[model samples]
Target chain A: MMRAVILAAPSVDALDNPALSALLGLIVITLIMTLGVMFATWYERKAVARMQQRLGPMRVGPWGLLQPIADTLKLVSKEGVRPASADRIAWDLSLAAIFVPAFLVLVAIPFTADWFVSPMDLSLLYILAVGGLSFIGFLLAGWGSDNKYALLGGMRAAAQLISYEIPMILSMLAVVMVVGSADVYRIILYQDVVPLIVWQPLAFIIFLTATIAELERQPFDIPTGESEVAGGVFIEYSGIRWSLFQLTGYVNMYAYSLLGAFVFLGGWEWPFGTDIGWGYQLLLTMVKMALFIVFFLWVRTSFPRLRVDQLMSYAWKVLLPFALAQIFLNGLVLVYDLPDVVLLATSGGGALALCWLVYSVVRVKPRQPLRMVGNVPATAPGSVSG
Target chain B: MPFEALLENYLAVFLATIVGTILVATALIGTRILAPYSKDRAKVTSYECGMVPIGRTRAQIHVRYYLFAILFLIFDVEAIFLFPWAVNVAQASHSAFWAMVLFIGILAAGLGYAWRKGVLQWNR
Candidate 1:
């Protein structure tokens, strides 16, 4: 009777050994990702400097490869200044709250076959959901600091993230519709034969644009536009607290690159059906990620900052509609037997055309330059418009 | 299970204990290295708009932020539950899907209720 009871209860040993291993593996991956973030900062500085025709950080170690390490040591040694009005507990907790979840998201990313920490069926959704948790940290930092600038920055980030999230998720849904699974591995496997980018090109474009905004990267970096807000939400943070935030940003950039590779660029899958070994596959994945990172840096150096309203409008009005249409088109393609290339090309072309039409209609006409609000005309003090 | 099996089963606990001890030691050392011992009137002054604060800086915030936080918690919990329900849907009968649809419908109704009540409204 006891044996039957034990059997019915589902033995704890039945939980599977691989599950435990996966959890440990995920922790290791997260650690590696954290290191990746530190390196990416160095990479970005060097890359951006190269674009500007200048030598970046070449003082610390060979070619300044250890610049991030030096930066981290300096930040660690510096004192963390807390505003007297600040909620100390909340401020301290906010750093952990932000950094931990960003680390946790790495677990859902697969590096190779049999390499994922937790093989979740809903890995993609899980990553998306957890990624939103960073906003809470931002809010906490803003509110906890009791500084108006920080508060405004935090609020802007929250609004920006929440707004971009809709289009981002919708774009991902287009991939899901094509692949019929939210599992990261499955999505990659589906991409093996033909990458989802081919079928969901519109979704790919929308996803890339929204993700750039989500990461608060160039063109969409109005939140941290130093000239306007004086460093935004991070103006108050100093020393290690500021370093942690910066670290989180770099890690998020890497995470986004990995996500792009998985969703659109056939993660760990070599082009032209070359069955590369696992080591080579990892190298390929890194190369693909580097290319995406370069693209990010390139855009940062190339484009001017987007106005807040324009950024929001692009996400909501432009990306969201096209993402929805792409999903619908994907559904139709799935239901019928059509030439895959033709279907994809037509859907992509249609989305682009629609976007162009909307763009033309909504394109802002250049207006007369505004007179400075406080500038008094030299000829007449009352003539504000002169 | 025998005592040996029980001991084997608890291997993870042993590993965690070792890791936890190392982490605690490192944290203590880090705190010692980083903490500043100096304190003075100027150092302790309340920071308020780059001026000495006139009144207590720790005033109570708006109650609506708390209300919204509570609402966020409720919805977050609902989302967490949906995960397991979603994973188990394939194992269940067709009724499971209908049941989920009904459940989600009710949740949506709650969201709508909150929206109508202005609980979800953020603007001051």
Candidate 2:
């Protein structure tokens, strides 16, 4: 069954027609993933609306199934505007920069054992390196736009992403430590009995939170905060260029979801010692990916946006310390020959405890009313202030 | 596969592609420069949304942006170093992990100092 699925993919036998096969595979995957992204958008709107007691996209296509498609068409047909002050070449390059790496990142992700295009030993590193490249694209988009808002958005995004990357990489290190290898396939294979989530719970939580921030998802989505920065780095983009940014965003969402599946949920692995066929394995993978996407949307709706300072502090102060502690604990577990389940439970509990402790410590206290020098009032009676 | 072999295969391909793209871009720019020799009064004039040229093509920008950029570079460069160190952590001695812990400890201290100094605060 696995062999058949592998053989069914056009890319599998494309060693004979390398270029043509690669192009075809690219098109197919792009279309499928695009559809997945479109559905994900609709799903998010509906889910969030339900959570908030409202209806979303009901008028589009049967509960807004076609809304994303409609939105895409509208965006494509819209007029593209270039500012007089903008750098045209960099502006165009920014779109390609943001998107190309996202496309390549998908290549390294394995949907199932045989379903992977080519299993490389360095898949995890490849993903991380490619993921980091998107920041260049984002930074260019902001700087090249020559708009204050765009520049601010881009800078904020750069700072946030660069800051959070520390805890994010550290969290992944915890996983790599337990798995004993950086290879995605080997990691999955190690999870044949129990997933890494069992042993590296803290790492899983930190990784997921940081990944969402890396993807610029909300509560950490100050980069594109509409109210504060007017759509952030994307404010200057229009027409197909804007669509490219949107497309990259959706692709990143899918890629992050797939990453979460591979690391924590145990890629293509069935729970409870059951051995399913290839078809069921593929289905299970999709289900896991969908569950992750829902998790992304759920968190977005449940939390308000974090202030920029708060976001940075959370990454550096909160997540970083806990990631360090978790790594230390994992080392202890390995040295002591503890059961995998025990290690997983204790690591996860430790992470949560550390987070709560950090949260309490970092909780901001209300500032005392500003004191005035001498007898002067802090503010005049009719004066307006922030 | 051995580590050396894997590195040779992937890194060689990656570097070759990057070099190829650079060569192609350079060739395109050279062709445009060597092929054209036309200059008109209109060509010398600045184009600003089809309006008359403004005072200057460049102006002073806010120093805050440069400050942020510098900070970003420092942290980004630090993050890059962590990647390889992380990959080799398993093979290294126990001292390596502790060294990393201390390294991160120093960086975290910097972050804390910046927070106290209001560098990370946005509203101000």
Top-DockQ candidate index: 2
Clash number by candidate, in order: 0, 2
- Residues B32-56, candidate 2: write the lDDT tens digits: 4443335455433332234555564
- Per-candidate TM vs. native? 0.74, 0.77
Return the DockQ of model 2.
0.13
Error of 1 at B55 (Å): 9.6
User: lDDT per prediction?
Assistant: 0.69, 0.71
Candidate 1, residues A1-386, lDDT tens digits: the string is 64465466645533455435544664576468657878889989999999999999999999999999888777777766677768877776677667766766776677876566555657788788878778878878877887666776776677677667766776776677566677888888777677777777777778788789989998888777787666777877777678778877888888888899888998886363436767777787888888789999999999898777666556545565565456445544554444677668866796678668657755655654555657853342333210
Residues B1-124, model 1: lDDT tens digits: 6765644433433443343334334533464488454556665443435667565433455565465455445545654555454434434455654565576567656756766776544443
Which stretches in model 1 have alpha-carbon errors above 4 Å? A1-20, A270-274, A354-386, B1-32, B35-37, B40-49, B52-124
Candidate 2: clashing pairs of residues: A198-A344, A199-A344
TM-score of chain B of each: 0.67, 0.57
